[model samples]
Target: MTALERIAEWVTSNPPVTAARRAAATDAFVDTLACMVAGASDVSTLGAIAVASHADPRESAMCVDGAMRAPSSAALINGTAAHALDLDDNFIGAATHASAVLVPALLAAARQAGADGAALLDSYLVGLQVQREIGREIAAKHYTAGWHATSTIGQIGGAAAVAHLLGLDATRIVAAMSVAVSTASGLKWQFGTPVKPVHAGFAARSSVEAALFAQAGVAGRSDVLEGERGFAALYGAPHADWPTAPIDTSVAHAIEQPGLFPKLYPCCGSTHLAIDAVLDLLREHSFAAADVAEIVVTVLRPNAANLPYTHPENPTQARFSMQYALISALESGTVSMADFEPATVRERRTHPLLDRISVRTWSEKAERIMLDQGRTPHRVELTLTNGRKLDRQREVARGAVSEPFAPWEKRRKFTSLSGLSDAHYDAALRLAASPNIDAIERLLAAAIRLRNGAGE
Candidate 1:
């Protein structure tokens, strides 16, 4: 059977769900909802909602603001909002912002099908697994070549999840995934722009549409992912090597393994490691931002490429700017959500510390060796005005599996970003045990109003 067929079969077979997987899924949902609330007013999300409001306005699925639109339109608006701040979690296995796409798309499908919270979590795991499986074959090559995996891989995997929620059979599941391939598209070069978040919107909308089409009896080539002139052949290396046998998931699921990476900082993930490294140095030594004469950061080539802005003119570009991120961390000892505000960017842009920062990338050969050895830390070098240099390297960010945020920290982030009452947060945490998705939708709607009223 083709890999896609295997995925469809496994999803339909009702694979076992572990307690750990359920917890992870629940956390992801809460985090994504918080991000959605925090980003609801972003220009990109507003733009998507404006377009969606005019498209169908069928009032079929719930949006962040409590209004209803067609399922696909809601997915587009919600997904855009979820990812607009670049604070959404990451799945290293798939090299995608898994939750940003999956949560919005699945929420829409779940409401349409009246699926319960358990079913929604199950569908999320299924979709993330599909992305990990496909990514094993092509993510590195695809991402390094400038494709946005969040949109490309996300559309395909999210379609399978939506299909599952819609109760499509394996045959129809294959059709949904195949149709998704045609819509899978996003470029990494669009990073640092409003278009970047819209990519998630596009993927979420396409996934919902693909699944709906399949449910309507539309079909496509079953081998569209691996056939001649297909997804892999067209999107990856011509001779990209795929596994001879499917990896075993019976004993361990992807979420319990490589896991989803939650972000502690609200900036492009590529900048996190460097920021962590700088923060480490500050903890060990006593020096204000003004005392720093020079700050140099060394990272992988792809990460450096992702951070092209040395002097960002706006908040969007600041998210992708290593110089801006490091300076913010150095000066304030933390990179808060407020750090990315327009006035903050404008004020910080002229700081002399911005000029003190410079970035360098490891050579391809060096990076390859580090990858093979299984450790590729981002390095930060700090030169003080007194001519003393402090060096630090961080292999993992604070919010990664190896170094997780405390429970209080997680709660703090959710409340701070979502601006919702603790009662809403409690409701979100109990989602796995809830009978339906009604509470979640209501909480998200309240979060939107509260966050907006606070002028965030």
Candidate 2:
């Protein structure tokens, strides 16, 4: 059988949903919801809302703003909003914004199907596992080749999740995945633009439509993933060994293993490690930003490539700029959302300190050695005016599984970003045991109302 078929079978076969897995899924939902709230007013989300609001058959799915849209359109708008700020969690195993796509797609499907919170969490774990399985084959090459894994890999896995939620059989699950494979597309060139988050919206919409189409008897090739002209061949992995082993979700789920990297800073995750490294140095030493002669950051080639902007002209580009991210952290002792505002970016762009930061990459041989050893390290070297050099290297950022945030830390982030109360955070925590997601939807609507009232 093809790899896609094997995945479909595993997806259709109900795996045991452990307590730990459910908690992880719930945590992901909370984070994605907070992101959706924070980014609701972003220009990218507005664009998605405009499109989704105009689609036919509206009122099928609830948006963050309490407005209703068609199911696919809701998925698009919600997904875009979830990722617009670039603060959503990252699953390194898949090299994608896993929850940003999964949560929006699953939420819409769950609401439409009247699925309870347990079902949503179950489907979330299932979809994340599928993404990990597929990402194992092509993530490194695909991401390096400049294809946005969040869209390409996300759609296939998201389709599986939506199919599971809608109670599709193995055969129809295969059909959904095949349809998703054909529609999945995104590029790294859109990194500094609003279209980057739209990639998540597009993936979410495709996942919904593909699964719904499969349920409606749309036929598709079952071998689309490993076929000669298929996903692996066309999207960076030419000769990838598809399906090396059966997916076993009986043990640890992907969310509990390599785990999701939740962002503390609202910028591209590529700059996160470097930011953490520099912060570590600053905390340990007595040097101020003005005391530094130069800042040198070293990361993997792909990360280096992701940060192409040295002097960002706007907030969007600032999110992808190593110079801006690092320097802002240095200047203010930490990077905050306020730093990325248009006026702040414009003011900081002319700072002489921006030119003092230089970014480099590890040699190809060193990168190969690190890759072979399963290490992704970002190093920061600070040269002071008195010739004192402080160096720090970070393999894991603050919010990664290796160094996770405490419960209070996570709650603090949620409240700070969404401008909601502790009751809302507790509501999200209780979702796993709730009868349905209706309460969560109401909380989200309240967040939208709050934000609108605050004129944010």
Candidate 3:
């Protein structure tokens, strides 16, 4: 069977979850909804999508805080919005933004099919579990070698969610899985452009199309994932021993034991550890930007070893640039939405900071220590003119596996992004904790109120 077939069969056979599991899924779904509201009005590609989506509106699924749209359009908008802040949770090992990408796609499918909140939550959790497994397996090769794990692995998550919502039999789920193979795409090379969110938009739209096609009995190659020219071989170099492991296509539970980590920072997951380390130093020691002579950051060779970023020319690229972000944090005290703008792209203040900051391979002991904790740790050393030296070592970045952001912190982030007032933020946080998608819809409407003049 194709790799896709294996996952589909598993989704079909997975048993009902306990109440606790369902509640956990509900929690994650609400977080994604908050992510959508926070990002909906971002001067991101999502806002433009919101505009374009309204052009051919259909009553399939809800937009951030507005009228219904065609299922495909709704998925696109929500997917875009969820990823708008670039602040969504990451599938840590896989490096894909888990909740933003997966939750939005699932919401679009669930709303279109008129599935209840309970069913929607179940499907969301199942889809995440499947995505995690796929990411764990595939990214050992594909993502490490440079493909964007988001598009490559996101298709499976999107497909799994649709299969659950549509009540597709194992056979049809397999069909959707195979057909989705043709739709899987996205690359790491496009990180800094408007095209990044478009990647999520396309994943959402194509999954809906794939599910509909499968519903129509459209056939596809069975082993699309394992075939000679299939996903494994074509996307990136596969791990040499992955073919030898006899994967049992029979997992019944979708939620991993601990569930996924919601993010605290708004940059590439790989950079979170370093950002956290640096921020802590600034906050703890209160380092003044003017006092620093040189800043050296120790990062994993694997994350940016082959990454050839000469200088970031845009905000999207800036998100992935450890040099740019650290530099911005040094000069600006914090990295905000404005740091991603075109005006700051090549500005002297930002660029000079980049020169002061240099990245080198982390020591073997450091790498082993951080990885053991399921987070990347960074060691930063800054030399000051007054003969003062500051050293900061972080085992994990903030908003990640270690040093996570709290609920209130996330709400503040949403309030800033969506321009929601304190009252609206409180309500949205409640929506995040609730199971009602309508409450989420209400939160979104309030978000739109904040979007009027906040042009991306």
lDDT of each: 0.87, 0.89, 0.67
**What lDDT score is found at residue 452 in candidate 1?**
58
The true-structure Cα RMSD of candidate 2 reads 1.5
Question: Which candidate number would show the highest TM-score if scored against the true structure?
Answer: 2
RMSD of 3: 4.1
Of candidate 2, the 10-residue stretch with the lowest lDDT total is 52-61
lDDT of 2 by residue, 1-456 (tens): 888889987887788788888998899999999999899989999999887677465467788767877889889999999999999999988899999999999988887777988999999998899899899888988899999999999989999999999999999999988889889899998899999999999999998999999999996888787889988898899888875577787777788888889999999999999998888888899678889899999999888888888999999999999999988888888888998999999998788878989999999999989977868999998899999989889999999989999999899999999898898899898888888887778787788778768532
Error of 1 at 29 (Å): 0.3
Candidate 2: the clashing residue pairs are none
lDDT winner between 2 and 3, please give it: 2
lDDT (C-alpha) at residue 3 in model 3: 63
Q: Candidate order by lDDT, highest to lowest?
A: 2, 1, 3
Clashing pairs in 1: none
Off by over 4 Å in 1: 55-58, 451-456
